[model samples]
Target: MSVIQILIINAVLVSIAMVVLWLVSLRLKDASIVDIFWGLGFVLIAWMTMAVATQDLRSILLVAMTTIWGVRLAAYLAWRNHGKGEDSRYAAMRDHRGGSFWWVSLVTVFGLQGAVMWLISLPIQVGSCETVPMSLPNYAGLIVWAIGFLFESVGDFQLARFKSKAENNGKVMDRGLWRYTRHPNYFGNSLIWWGIFWVSASSSTLWLAISPILMTFLLLKVSGVALLEKSLANRSGEYRDYICRTSAFFPWPPARRHGSKLV
Candidate 1:
């Protein structure tokens, strides 16, 4: 199978999976499970791409890197989302749309997400399909992946800890990574894929063209930072104040708000 064919196959499979999940969600009355499936779906896509590609050093390296990323990410997201109810974003959509939610969600939510997933996976597909040897770019990709992984893991841990504490319950978390960026976890996630794309850019294919850009757009404009921050900004007063000081999607030194002292 050619690289393009492999990508199409991966996209179709994930789309079908999402459609099935959407149908099930309509019956089960929850959508958090979709989050778990989304993560796992990417792992499956990466592996499938590797399997389809002709055996070569590049293919092997791509598989190894992607598997490490996909597996860890899937596990973390699944563990975090376990037993949680529907994500607020979907729930809000359901509430607003009412009975029309079934169709709306199937096409707009599930289908759209499936397409984006495929777009974001383009770098992995391109990287894995081509033959290339170990090089500086590959090493750089690993370093970027490691840094992104740490940021994501640490950000998640800090937020989880804050939520678990009694006194901190329902409060905006402004310590640790959260103090620097409103969505450090998301920032890390975005960086990781860009790193993956950079590694893959060594490939003959130019498929990395869409991967990093799509991921960033999704993180900033679509579902990642925008949706979550919108909800937080509405619910938490401290969140608004934090936003005034902290960067939205990148970690940086907190800037002082008018009349507010920097900590």
Candidate 2:
């Protein structure tokens, strides 16, 4: 099949899976489970694309990076939400809306996430669809993707540990990786897709250009970074204080502005 055909097929199939899973979530009353599924679902799409590969190293590398990220994120989210009740975000929305919540979840939550997933998968879509052979740029892209993968993995580990620690329980995480950025995980995630896009850019397709830019936009402006941070901001007073000294997205040293109001 042609590259565009492959992407559209993947998007449709993934969207259908999300819809089915979401309906199941309504029955089970859990949306956090969807988050895990979403991550693992990307892995499925990436490998499906890889299976159709034509001896391209870029395709192989992209598949590997995406699989690594997807598996890690799925495992972490699944473990974290293991015994916890339904995600409070969804629970609050459901309670506030009452009976129409099923419809609300369909369009606003599950459908929205599925769209974001498709947008983020642009790199993989582009890589799978490209007709050109890999080159130096592709190798560089793989390096960049590896960096993002490591950063995200380590940042998640650090934050998870901070949260689990006795003294830091229910406190804002402001040490180690978290000290450098308010949302290291988001930063890493943004980098990963951009790297993938760069690899895919070897194709010279204008439509495919939307992939990295869209990923960056979402990480910075929409559901990935903004929504996650906003929720945390409301949940933790210390988060505001952490935000004051640390960078918002990029990993950078603190400004060292002492005696300033954290809020």
Candidate 3:
């Protein structure tokens, strides 16, 4: 099969999966399930590519990387969302759409997410399909991916643990990775996709750089930082102070936030 054909097939498969999950979400009355499926969608594409593409080191590497990242994220999200009901974003949409939400979610939520998943998996598509030895860029991509993995996994773990504590309630999380950046997991997620892009970087597939750039944008503006902060900003004044002192997206040495004195 040609690369284009394989990519087309991957998109079709994910689209079908999303449609099916959308139906399931309708039955469960919980749109948040789609978040758990997001990771699995990429896993499906990687495995589907592995099936069609020739077995080689490049293919194996891509599959391994996607599999580890995808499955870990899927499991974590599934666990975290247990008994949480629908996510606020979807709940608000449901409230807005009311009786029309079922079909609306199928197109706006499921179909849209499926397309984005396929778009972001461009690195896997290019790398797994191409036959090449591991190069410097590939090695660097692997190292960068490892760093991202640590940052994402540790950040999520720290946040979860902090939330599990009772005393920390109503307090801003300024410990561990949160102390550095407001969204370490989101930063790490952006880095992971960029690392994947670099892994597959070649004269032919350089155009696929859009994949990582899109992921970075989504993390920063769409679902990761801007979306989360809308509610968090309403917390205590300490959170506002944290926002003032800490970097918004990137990790750096935190500076003290000053208040106007005797104005």
TM-score of 3: 0.96
Taking all chains together, each candidate's TM-score versus the true structure is 0.88, 0.89, 0.96
- For model 2, how does the per-residue alpha-carbon lDDT over 185-208 read when each residue is reduced to its tens digit? 888887787677777767465466
When sorted by TM-score, best at the front, the candidate numbers are 3, 2, 1
| lDDT-superior candidate, 2 or 3 | 3
Better of 1 and 3 by lDDT: 3
For candidate 3, write residues 111-159 as lDDT tens digits. 9999999999988987887766778988798888888888899999999
What stretches of model 2 exceed 4 Å from their correct place?
53-55, 231-237, 258-263
lDDT of 3 at 200: 74
> Which ranges of candidate 3 are over 4 A from the true structure?
257-263
Worst 10-residue stretch by lDDT in candidate 2? 254-263
* Residue pairs with backbone overlap in model 2: none
lDDT per model vs. reference: 0.78, 0.79, 0.87
Best by TM-score: 3
**Candidate 3 at residue 251, lDDT?**
84
